[model samples]
Target: MNHQEVGKYWNENAQTWTTLARAGYDVYRDHLNTPAFFEILPDIQGLKGLDIGCGEGHNTRLLAQKGAFITAIDISEVFIQQAKETETQHPLHIHYQITSAAELPFAENTFDFATAFMSLMDIPETGKVLSEACRVLKKSGFLQFSIAHPCFDTPHRKNLRNAQGKTYAIEVGDYFTNQNGDISEWGFSNLPESMHNLPKFRIPRFTRTLSEWLNIIIQAGFVIEQLHEPRPSNEVVKQYPSLQDSQVIAYFLHIRCRKS
Candidate 1:
């Protein structure tokens, strides 16, 4: 799908995304991706930052609370509204806008750093978005992002098990092929009753191979700084039992890059 179609898909699913965010990014992000990301993040005290694809501004608010003057943007109007409402509830120095990542609306070299947390895979034009990120950052500025591991989270994924039915390995297909559309169910069984009753949810996503992701950032004038493949901790598994197998299978990849 094209950028416009991708935006429309997100707009249609914004309410569900908002509900998921409100339910907390704790299980998915906090327990899984955040630790690896923060390890490479420099102190943001007294810095200007941009949060591309900042869903409901949860992570953007964290940036503000950490002392970064944040400018957060999302393509979905409903998501932007929800973010603004969050800002009103608890005042912060955050400027929120409804804008696409492919075309950022900011002066060149305006931000010290930028971030896209688990958002790149959802965007159709990854190269364009990365270029826009580079255009907005000062020389030597950094961008930290996390996404579902393209290799493991392929268009077709399956678990390989033995006679005992214990997952030994994961099987993936179409690893090198770029693919998009509503490939997976978005709604979870454990969601709140109000959320469960909502219509069937299937969000659009675009997938690129690992090399494609790296090449895009390099072409956008970035040098790779750090790469992390995070697995849920044993403690986390105790709290969220379903994530036990995640400890063995890589679920997410985090990258830190600096503008050259």
Candidate 2:
């Protein structure tokens, strides 16, 4: 898969994401690791917040409910459309804008908190995006970005093994990401018997190792304050013993850092 072709895939799968997330949130909470209120919500309050790649405006609407004036931006107009529809149904006043995470349209020091929930890896130009995130965050402001853990969330590493050897396996060729970015395979799951439940396809995902993820923020002049590796809850523990002490430590990291 062409690494560059993935973000567009998100545009295509925009509506399905909401459906998938809604389904996961309700039925399969065990497979999900979404932290309550965007990981760093507790650290900052009553300040301007930016939600980059605000798909379906799920987290954006959450931040608004918590009293942060938010600017929600995304690259896909289709996603924006779906997000606005969701907003109308939910009725939250999050300012939605169609924009790319790589090149934010806002001025410097424009926000107090910048968060991209599970979306940074989907954007193509993360360096520019992070720089823009830094540019807009106020001094002492926070940036909390989360992504699928690079080590384990990877498709290659994501699988199931039984006594028969391999019961279920999907493509896992794309893993390491360099300065240029990594193109990874992705797909969607349709509700049974519904062809339009979602389109299944491949796309690219970008991320750095935990060290690289941390160092970039430091070089960008932010001080790491708290690092969160959310362990699976008891339900997960009781359900999947195979995930015990695996090569992957955390499925996601909630980094709270300040631009100091």
lDDT tens digits, residues 10-112, model 2?
7776766666766642222224345432444564457789998887786687778778888899877777888888778877667899877777898988998
Write down the TM-score of every candidate: 0.92, 0.78
Tens digits of per-residue lDDT for model 1 on 15-42? 8777765776346676667766776678
lDDT of 2: 0.66
Q: 195 in model 2: Cα distance from truth in Å?
A: 6.9
For model 1, the stretches where C-alpha displacement exceeds 4 angstroms are 160-167, 192-197
lDDT agreement with native, every candidate: 0.83, 0.66
Ten-residue segment with the worst summed lDDT in candidate 2?
24-33
Q: What ranges in model 2 sit over 4 Å off?
A: 1-6, 25-32, 36-40, 158-198, 236-249
lDDT leader:
1
Error of 1 at 243 (Å): 1.3
